[model samples]
Target: KLQMTREEVLHDIAELTSYAKEHYSTVLFSAEDATRSDLNFLIKANQIAVENGATRINIPDTVGTITPNAFGYIVRKNYEALPKNVRIAVHCHNDFGLAVANTIAGFENGASEAQTTIIGLGERAGNASFEETAMSLYALYRIPMNINTRKIFPTAKLIESYCGGKIKIGRLQPLIGQNAFAHESGIHAHGMIKHARVYEPITPELIGIRRSDEVEQIVKQSIKLGKHTGGHALKAKLEDLGIHPTNEQFQKIFNHVKSFGDKGHEVMEEDFLAIVKDVMGELPEEEQYVKIDELTVLTGSVTPTSTVRLKIKNNGDQIEKTASSIGVGPVDASMKAIVKCFEPMSKVKLLEYNIDAITGGTDALGHVSIELMDLETNQIVQSSATHEDIVMSSVLALLKGLNKIMKDKNSKN
Candidate 1:
């Protein structure tokens, strides 16, 4: 219908309304670009449709060009000009980023229903978002809605997945985005630690989500270690990690972290923990039973092999031993060699070994966590180490766990 005249549109609507009334229980007459239509003619068209049996009239901002105040004014005009029995609905687009605003405005003035889509999925700039509209209505206007708030995230995720790139949720999108409830800054985290409401408009639990304290603490510690750090903050972070370093050890760890920051390197949590371990010494005095003197590994297309030299202390005497082994990989071979060297103490078996890159890039920190079982004592222990070399990190973690098991056995004896 190019250059549709008001009279022609009204004549068509009257005929459609009459036909719809006989066959359908309800009829809705939607005026495309209603905001731009002649107000007087628009009112007449709506009245004719309602008189002929249309149940509702919808006013849509087709190109999304109208302001909230203007939209409210138009809705108010239609509300007054139309018959008292007719219902009004508003369909708004987000070209001007005011669809929700205009929708709420129209509802506040007189509209009874709103037209919305999930995550504002529609043509061009899209339509008003149901989540935004429903949440705003309930939270800001005190309007009670029967929406299940907990299902909001799950539903949004399903829709987003089905869209398959047609719609992308903004990282900072309100309520459901990844960063919606994430706090990165130390100041913000500090405030949130005291009272979450200070930084968050609503708790994540209200939306069926749980806040990650470990992630938040990692961010807070990263910021402090990467930028300017205070003694209190540093102490708190170390204490949180269950590492109560002595005064001298604290000074060394702090200086090492600051040096890394000054060199333009990110001091991650793993890096800080590694620094603390290096400064405080690997094992406590009583737990110092076995130590790695030297290790060499050879791998690649050829058979993987390793040689390990270890120093074991017993009754103030140091005994050194060397062992060699072959396995599927460098880490496996190294573990076999270390176990061979410590065969006299206990039958130590590496039950589990896991490694993760703590940071990006080829020089990323490799964090190795291992679970060791002492078959002789039937005791299990877990420990971890972080380093740039995966094999060394794994060996160190295994040795740490072995030391714990040996220390416990000695204390019992």
Candidate 2:
């Protein structure tokens, strides 16, 4: 399949490198599937390239099956056999979750450069993750890499946007995942309360996760009270929120959280706050930041359109606004109209709206879940509501998410 013999391949390398040297000041050569290729031939191919003027030789673990020890040996052999003037680079693939380890091994063995893709994008199995590898070298190995460490989170987000939903990075992914710094276990939360570094390998600030100026904000987000939560964990999180309660109030909240978690629900941040406020008698109707006066939508064989009357509180000053917009459906129209009144809100953009019918019938109750994200800070909030009218349900869930974002934003000021 190569379409050429060994002698012909070396001849082509010589011709290509010689020809490219005239125009390009730098010439890099790579032997495809070098790890699996015959070592002598690969070395000879690379030697011929350098003799003809190649400045760099890239060794690729094309099949992604090479072990770290084997990869280190290959890099070392190539580093020793190849001319001292040329730089050696390793291109590893994560077929076995060893791309990061292999790339680091190359550095530890002698390879001068690392070839990686953001989020480890590549064919089939991904290549070495630039963020993971660079962070490992910078943080774990203490290798002072020349990159703006703070931009790691944003750059990954930009790449995700470019992917356009094709490649979604899970929240549990290291370094950039939402839960990477989130502590969910009772013991982990207790340890985190004592010292961040006790559970977190690094501080959130090292990766630009400063969502608030208050340490309590950071602490509250990190400790997720869930099924594994204990009384101590609950107390720690409540104290972070500055909520001091009577023993009875504390017992009531604790039982509620345990019961909720017992039913397989990992209570979210907004839901947790609602629970605390309800128990504290602070859940006044007036506490709602935005309220809908009225919402009307017209559809059925026409452009789906809606209009709304809304009263929103801006810094304790009630403001009334009315607006209308057209959408693909009545639900979309109604939600947009509601969002219009809360216009000039924060950069919290609607990410997703999902609905599931709990029963199979025309009058089946539908549960709606909505996610809103602050584009600037990438903070996400989720809310849900169940109702017979799906449109109203979506609006309620979206508003809940928006209210959470508003409360969080306002808390900072």
Best by TM-score: 2
**Backbone clashes in model 1:** 0
* Candidate 2 residue spans exceeding 4 A from truth: 211-215, 281-413
- Each prediction's whole-model lDDT (CA): 0.80, 0.80
Model 1 C-alpha lDDT per residue in residues 1-413, reported as the tens digit of each score:
55777678888889989999999988999978999888888888888999899889999999999999999999999999887778899999999899999999998989978999988889899999888888788778888778887777778888999988968888878888867875544576566556657777776666656443344443352234644555655666777777888786788777766665666666666787776775565566556788999999999988999999998876567899899999999999999999999988788888888988878877666788888899987799888876667898889888888788778877787
Error of 2 at 109 (Å): 1.1
**Best lDDT among the predictions, by candidate number:** 1
TM values, all candidates: 0.61, 0.67
RMSD of each: 8.3, 14.8
